[model samples]
Target chain A: MMEITEGSHAVAEAVRLCRPQVVSAYPITPQTHIVEALADFVANGKLDAEYITVENELSALSACVGASAAGSRTYSATTSQGLLLMTEVVFNAAGMRLPIVMSIANRAVGAPLSIWNDMQDSISLRDAGWLQFYAEDNQEATDLHFLAYKVAESKEIQLPVFVCFDGFILSHTYEPIDMLLQEQVDQYLPKFDPAEKLDAKDPISFGMYATPEYYLEFRYEMDQAQKRAKDVIAKAGKEFGTMFGRDYSALTVGYLLDDAETVIVAMGSVCGTVKDAIDEMRAAGKKVGLLKIRVFRPFPSEEIAKALSKVKRVAVLDKNISLGAKGGATAIEVRDAMYGSMIPVKGYVLGLGGRDIRKKDIKEIVSLCENGIGDQFYGLRKELI
Target chain B: MTLAVGCRARPGKSRDNKTGSWRVFKPSFDHEKCSKCGMCQTLCPEGCVHEDAEGFFDPDFTYCKGCGICATECPKEAIAMNQEEK
Candidate 1:
């Protein structure tokens, strides 16, 4: 039987089920509940794991990488500033092929430092060799932990996984999250055994400096591994569906995409609101759709292009900026994918730095797509013309 | 031996050794053919291709990825892709 609980508590329970040998994380608003609940589980002896209270997010990921290297399943959590601080180690975890699953409460990285929901923090590190999954709700967030672990630990693609959820919107808000039971989780995720470990039995050098002659090959191999992960993610999601009765799309999620002429492409918690908007729009006989990007790092180019190719127009809503570029980071990737395909996809920069993302704003974005103008900014406060 | 579709046959290892095996010439200039166009010099991303003291051009294949961009983009067709044995 699955328990219906708050999103943070649900993710915490799921992590506990994964039975990580070591758990480490720093405290940050909106992402605090996940760590706090894990700490509670540790204190109560419900989880048999080493819970390390780290000084910073860098240490948090570093501890996870160390534990994973030592042949153990590890877990961690963080938000905006915390995620930003851990960026270097995040890349290291992926490059080193450590299968650590981290729950990132997606927040706006800022000058003002607001602890609210947005995709900026994680979006900034899209090329950092991690398998990223943006959860639309508490239930998806809970289930993604299991799926992320399976895919990341797969022999074909051993990389760290970032299961992203909106900061305040999904992390703080209470929702009916149906989390799997302990026995089921155990049945689904077998004990993690690293093929190559930092063990005394086989003393091998790790992260050694490579010269120009060998460095490009190593990076290319890592890129090739990530490409391999695309298939692994799909296979894992399929196995998960059979075991737990939930199907999570590996790369992209399509809502009313079939027979629709225009679509709004989004990610993270904003997708939930976008879906709601799409439902209402369809009810009024509008042929609009939504495509939520679940995996950003791998770019999901072919999948995104295939999904949006049939549509005449698309509005790519991005929460992160490339700064000095014409399009947002993800928007540029999507546009590049659709470049020769003849699909008129426009990019919109919106909801940056914890700004409120209302459903009406998404509706306006779709309406703008209908207008056929190129790229435009949405919800930007203007003083005077 | 039958090679795979895209796989090229490896030349003699000893012969390659004698002639700088798998070395990429990357086109050092023939000044007689060179117009001092600086086409190859300008297009190289690695900055390996450059003008010499005599205004003739040369490419330092030691640092090149062999991306062939310079060879592809030289307007004068001065840069030719040459292969040396390893």
Candidate 2:
């Protein structure tokens, strides 16, 4: 059914349809609506699940870890500082191999303390061993929840996942979403059947201490599982497309790259603005296009290489910076992907702390990539500096 | 051999690892001075101290790292941490 709804409520409805056995979360800005809606569902008897009202984000995820270990499909959501608070257990959940699904209403982290939309929070934890999916719009945000659970609960890939959508930009905004019916979702996602669980009938221990002799091997296996997720994501995404009409089979999706000389790479809701900018630029005879990355983790190097093989130059727009690194995280990886090909890749750190990324800014970035004048902060207030 | 997913293992696998090898000093029980109060057994961090048929507590030594917590906590000074003679 298609209806106009807030993005957080849409995500909550999608999660409800997936039939999560446990929902635990601490209410933080932007993220509060998602858990609030889920709480309403459980309270009104619309959904049969345990709603754990926790005091903080750490406990929210810790509750999820315990619930998931005990053989229940669990979920949690948070953003920015809340996500940072859950850092220790974030690594533990992935290391323990619990297939828990989390929704990250992507927000900027702080020294200055701004609760605005940015990719910094989730981007900071890219190495924490979770499959990350960035959505371009609310519809993709809603749809990705179903896809996240299916992939996370797969026997071969039992790692956790982060379905990241821009905070306030997508979460607070109302958009027309084609919400899946309970029966349709049921047909797509099976009940969570854990391969190993905390059952007293057959005792087992998880997250045991790995001595120096065994620690390296455990990490190697985790790396291998992450590499294996590419195939699992492809299969699950294809299956979702087969069932639903919208296909998300590609990791890096291209828009008008057939005869383009310059390509702009980005993730999250900014892709919507970039697309509109690209259409306008195309009319004025600028050979420009976009390659929006849906999957950020297990960084799709090979697919990215193939997609941008013909482009003369690449511009990566990052909402988060690596601080001391030469470029943003996405640019650093994109450059590595196109290393031997000798394509000039430039990275621009823009839209931090919810600074507006207007179409004019994107158009100017395209011009900067064309004129060979990037690889620095794109928009800075010189007068303020 | 395939590793268990998530480094999970069956219970009691710690038995295979003899932590006692880490002991630099062994706790020797002076049974004559012992009160049979089971203080050593209650205070053992590794739970390796147990009572025998005579009701006198002794450390299992297989899993004891000789931390000497029981020796320190014993009221009657019945347990002593003697340096292991290499």
Candidate 3:
């Protein structure tokens, strides 16, 4: 059904269609609407699920971990400080190999308190063994939830996933989304039938203490599973495209790179603005394009390298900085992917703490990249410094 | 060898570890002075102390780490922790 709806409501509807047995979350800004809509679904008999009201984000993800371990499809949502609070359980859920899917309403972490959008929250947890999918719009945000569960629950890749969309940009905005029917989602994603679960009859333990002799192998196996998820994600994404018209088969999707000299790479809802900027730049005779990264965890290194192979220079727009590093996390990884190619890769860190990133800002960044003036924070107020 | 997914294991695998090798002190049971109250068995953290056929309790050295809880909890002072020669 094609209807204009709020991003959070659309995601809530998508989650309802997936039929998670347990939905656990603590309400945080931007993410609250999704869970609130879900709570209404469970309340009005629209969805058959247990809505576990937790006290905080830690308990929220902890409840999901417990429910998922007991062979139930579980979910939770958090952002920024909330995600930081759930850090311990986050790693435990992945290490335990529970196919729990979480929604990360990407928000900026605070010291000088701010409630806004940035990729810092989920980006900081990139190495935690969970597959990350960044959404470019509300439609992709809503649709990625279905793909997240399908891939997470696959037998060969039973790892948790984070479907991250910009906090206010996607979660609080209204857009026309083609919501999936329950029947369609059911055909795409199967029931949560875990190979191992916490059944009293089975008498097995999960996440048991591993001595030095076995701990390394356990970590190695988890890494292997994460690597295997790339194939599973591609297959599931293709199947989804076959069932639904929207395909997400590529980890990184390119726009107008056929004869481009400068390529702008990014993730999340900012890609929408970047695409618009690229179109405008193309009209002005600038050979610019975009390579938006959909998946970040099992980073499409080879695919990314191949996609940007012929570009003259690369500009990576990172919404989150790596703190002490010269560039954002995405730029660091992209540079590593483009290693030995002799291509000059420039990183521009911008839009932190939800400073608006407009088409003009992207154009300015492209000009700066052309002038070889990058690897620094973009759009910083000179007076403040 | 293939490891279990998620480091999961079946119950009772703890018995194979022989944790008694970690014991520096061993609990010697003095059954002659013992009352069959089973306090030592009740207080054993490892649950390694079990009652013999005569209703007196002895610690199973195979799994007991010699924590000395049994000796301290014995109401009759019938258990003693002595330094193991090993």
Candidate 4:
């Protein structure tokens, strides 16, 4: 069934169809509605699952971790501080190779406390050994949940997955989405059965320590597992599109980059705004294009290099900052991915701490991509300040 | 770095095998009571304990050097120590 719905509601519907055995979380704004809806499903008997409302985000992840080890599909969602608080468990889940799916409502971390959109919280944990996927709109957000389960539960790639959507942008924005039927989702994602689990009848070791001589090998094995996910992700995504009518580009999805002289690179909700600008600029006969990076970790370096191989200039726009560093974090990675290539890569840091990023601002970015300095910063008004 | 396996010392000048060089001491378990839940195995900083085919657990005394970590961390309390004569 298709319906015009808020992005959060769409996400809730997608999660419901996935049929998680355990849904546990702590309530934080922007991410609260997601868990609240799941709670409703559990309360109303719409979904048969254990709904664990913990005191804090840490325990939320902890409870899910416990449940997952006990051999059940588990889920949780959080924003900013709640995400940060769950950092330990986040790494643990990945290290343990549990196929737990998390929805990170992209928000800024706080000492001053701002409940707004930014990719800082999720971006900071890029090296924590989880596969990361960013959604550009409500449709993508809804679809990524299904893909997340498939990718995470694959026998070759048994790692946790994070499906990130911007806080209050996609979370609060309304859009028309074609919801997948429960049977369709079932066809796409089979029940999760971990190779090893905490079975009392089995009585085996879980998370045993390795000595210095052996610890590095375990970490290396996990790295190898992530690399295997690349192929599994592509196959699963393509199959989902064939069965459920949603073809999510598993790695990097490009738009109109062929023979393009200037390109703007971006992710998340901002990419939708950039695409509108690209269409307008292309109609004016300007050789401008946009590349939306769907997967941020296990970064599709080779795919990205192949996509941007022909481009003469690239302006990477990031919604998060690395703080006192050279450029936007994603831009740095994109540039490195194109390191040996001859493309002139530039970066622009924009929309931090939930700043408004209008289409005009993205157009300005395209202009900068055309005839301005490399590594520019957008959404800054120095004179007004 | 040499692997700890071939380690030996001169007679009478031989180091006490009990505590090795460590000041603190921790107990190791016999293969009898270990259920091999791996609670202590994962939590140990020294990573001294090992498991066998029957799910029994053992700690390497050469590397263990008595941290007491595995003793307290064990969920089943399967380990105890014999203190050296004062």
| Best by the DockQ measure | 3
Provide the DockQ value for model 3: 0.55
lDDT of 1 by residue, A75-169 (tens): 99988899889999988887777889999888887777677667888888878888788888888888889998998888777888899988877
Residue A196 shift from truth in candidate 4, angstroms: 1.2
Clashing pairs in 4: none
lDDT, candidate 2, B9-83, per-residue tens: 888866555778779999999999999999889878899999999999899888899999998999999888989
The sequence of per-residue lDDT tens digits that candidate 3 reaches over residues A30-114 is 7999999999999999989999998999999999988998999998888999999999998999899999999999999988777
TM-score of 4: 0.83
Error of 4 at A266 (Å): 0.7
**What is candidate 4's lDDT per residue for A101-167, written digit by digit as tens?**
9999999878668898889999989988899999999999999999999988887777889999999
Q: What TM-score does each of the candidates earn?
A: 0.81, 0.87, 0.87, 0.83
After TM-score superposition, the amount by which residue A230's alpha carbon in candidate 1 deviates from its true location, in angstroms, is 1.2
Q: Highest lDDT: which candidate?
A: 2
lDDT of 2 by residue, A161-199 (tens): 999999999999999999999999999999999999998
Model 2 misplaced stretches (Cα beyond 4 Å):
B16-86
Give lDDT for model 4. 0.83
Residue A287 of model 4, lDDT score: 86
User: How many Å off is the CA of A209 in candidate 3?
Assistant: 0.8
What is each predicted model's overall lDDT from 0 to 1? 0.80, 0.93, 0.92, 0.83
TM-score of 1: 0.81
Question: Per-residue error at A369 for model 1, in Å?
Answer: 1.2
Candidate 4: where is the Cα deviation over 4 Å?
B1-61, B64-86
Ranking by DockQ: 3, 2, 4, 1
